[model samples]
Target: MKSSFVFLCISATLAVLTITSAAPGRGNANATIPANRTQNGTVTCAGLNDQKKALEGFIAAFVAILFFGSNFVPVKKIDTGDGVFFQWIMCMGIWLCALVTQLVLSFHPNNNNNLNQTVPVPFEPEALLGGFLWATGNMFCVPVIKCLGLGLGMLIWGTVNCLGGWASGRFGLFGVEASLPGNEAENFSGVALCLLGVIMFVFVKSEGKKTKSNETDDERAHLLFSKKIQAETESTTLKDMSKASDDLDDSWVDRLNPKVKKIVGTVMAIAAGLLFGVSFDPVTHLEQSNCHNPQNGLDYAFSHFCGILLTSTSYLIIYCFIKKNKPQVIGEAILPGLLVGVMWAIAYGAWFIANANLTQTISYPIVATAPGLVSALWGIFIFAEIRGVKNLVFFSFACALIIGGSVLTALSKS
Candidate 1:
């Protein structure tokens, strides 16, 4: 126990050091950014250096996609007590990760940024609203993953998230100005193709809901028993463990029928996507609402993370009361939670950087497609979530649609 605590402290210190390492040289990066602006009011690359900004945007999109796809990997390691408890710790980690960006951008000299003169904005706390909304939406993630499997779950939510976020930036939803790429029709086409890809995957038939034919009830019970023993230390026979398991399966989520599980999973995934669509709402709101110093870029990252922490905490508090002050506390969640938080922070950091350098129309679609691809890959190869030649064929076609759509979206900006 002490060792885990010590490890977490060291990891956190490293996170700070890693983020701060780039602080002094931020100007080096700022030098690369183009001074781009849209007449509609969103901040993106100035038309002056189109090729350069596109390249930078693509890079940021790549990073965001990779990290976002893998952020939940740590949660798979330990059994989260009630998921809410796990989510709370995960959000705490996310907040800590957000601090890295907040510190770097807050303390760094912004005068040197190439876009400074054009954008002329300062950090705004309104970004907190974006984070808060996102946190509220994110609470459904664990359940979604459990229900849909990573591939279908991520694909559905990611595709929908792409639609919402891109539409918001494209048409200026919720007070944000529209982001017009050079080719509006082509941009819409890309989003449509991605949507098509999601539809294809929907029919791909992931055999995830099927229980293993070989595993008997006794074996399943033993595995659960062993996990509990490892998580907290208990020595008992299989019969005793089986008895304990019968009494503990009380949550409605645990009692879901397979068909209901599929339906609920799909619904939860859609909810997650809708939430993701608006996760950045507050930041956009600041730019559109013309709040004080109405800045764009990484400056909003800190407050956004704080919003996540705040919203998540509120949920946990409500949950405590709902469960009669018996919140399921997962002790093993700390280090993994921190790691996952950093992963998301890094991904979001890259996303903010992409927002600064790329057209929202292009960046959003490209980013949205790739993470679903990544998660699908993990599901297929790592978790055996999908198999059989028919499924593989559909998977290939779906991937083609996603990749093709992402390319189309990126080209729309060009």
Candidate 2:
């Protein structure tokens, strides 16, 4: 027990360090934005805008890290004893409340029937995949937390998730495991090795441009000469090319190439997975912390409300900043956010019930591994991410390590 407490302390310290180290770098990343804005009072408007952007990035990253990191600190306070049912009730209430708030805020009071105007939902494949993956991940994690304990479960889960994220980006499953034995530590090791393999597979540069996948030496020479020749020939072609670029930028998904598109998809998948993995810990924490008082339901309620609001709102804000001049984009953002909110509430709620029927050590590893398998399968079949004999060999070794890690972690009595 004392050792467990010590481990927890170390984990907490590490979490803090990760956040601290990342924050300032993100802030400085926006330094160039200040040069473009107009001046105001004493401060340059550009500088102010840059500062705001930096601050927003910090807040977004901080909340994201908190959401992801919360898994280690299970809600040991407010169990409510009703298990999954309680989780359901809480989630349902939160969803309803959020929906109502969204409706109210989105509506304009002065115009006739304006407030009642329905939001037109887009055909968003990414949102669909995200919600489904997240829901599945949540269901799986209850079992993992039961088996693995909060700290180690989250660690391996996070580690595998990181690799799964990379695979989903380049050419792997969305968030599923491709193939590995049911062992947790080995599974994670597999994911790590797979990550290494992927690193070997792709040639990345500091600017994210140069790659081993480029044309041969002669082809490069020809391309460079052609570019110079084209530049000398006509300014009109340059203008036309710039116009074409603008048009491509207008469509939301057009900006994404296969590689970037996969990354975006994978990011959405992992966001859902992370949510699923951490779902039960908060409930468990709440149960342990607030079992003595009935009215303290508000504590758990407020915390979850904050969680949902933080995630959805940050997503909206970030999207707006990324795609400036498209304020109407918020209309399209509604459904996906709403879908995620609903799915999130339900997944977490259901797992809380599942936890009542099992031990955390038994439950968590299974949960963590399920989406991993799903992601791997998606990579192989749906996305056709893996190929060639050498790649396959590397993939197999990675799978073995992932399984070994999972087994070690799950069987840990510590």
Best by lDDT: 1
Instruction: Name the runs in model 1 displaced over 4 angstroms.
Output: 1-48, 113-123, 143-156, 203-222, 226-247, 254-269, 288-295, 380-387
Tell me how far the alpha carbon of residue 9 in candidate 2 is from the true structure, in angstroms, after superposition: 42
- Candidate 1 lDDT score at position 322: 82
lDDT of 1 by residue, 1-414 (tens): 457446545644564453333222232333334555766876665454555555666776777887787776666546687688877887888888776556556555554445343222244567878887788778887777778676688777877798888888888887778888988888888888888887787667655424486664456667887787666435767787676565465566657898999999999889889888877767766644643342345667777888889899999999899877877777877778777787777778777667656646678777766676776687788667678899889889989998888888877876
Best by TM-score: 1
Q: Taking the tens digit of each residue's C-alpha lDDT, what string does model 2 give over 5-106? A: 465445534533332222221102222443544455465666665455334333432333232323322232222221222333333444564344334323
RMSD each, Å: 6.8, 24.9
Name the lDDT of candidate 1.
0.71
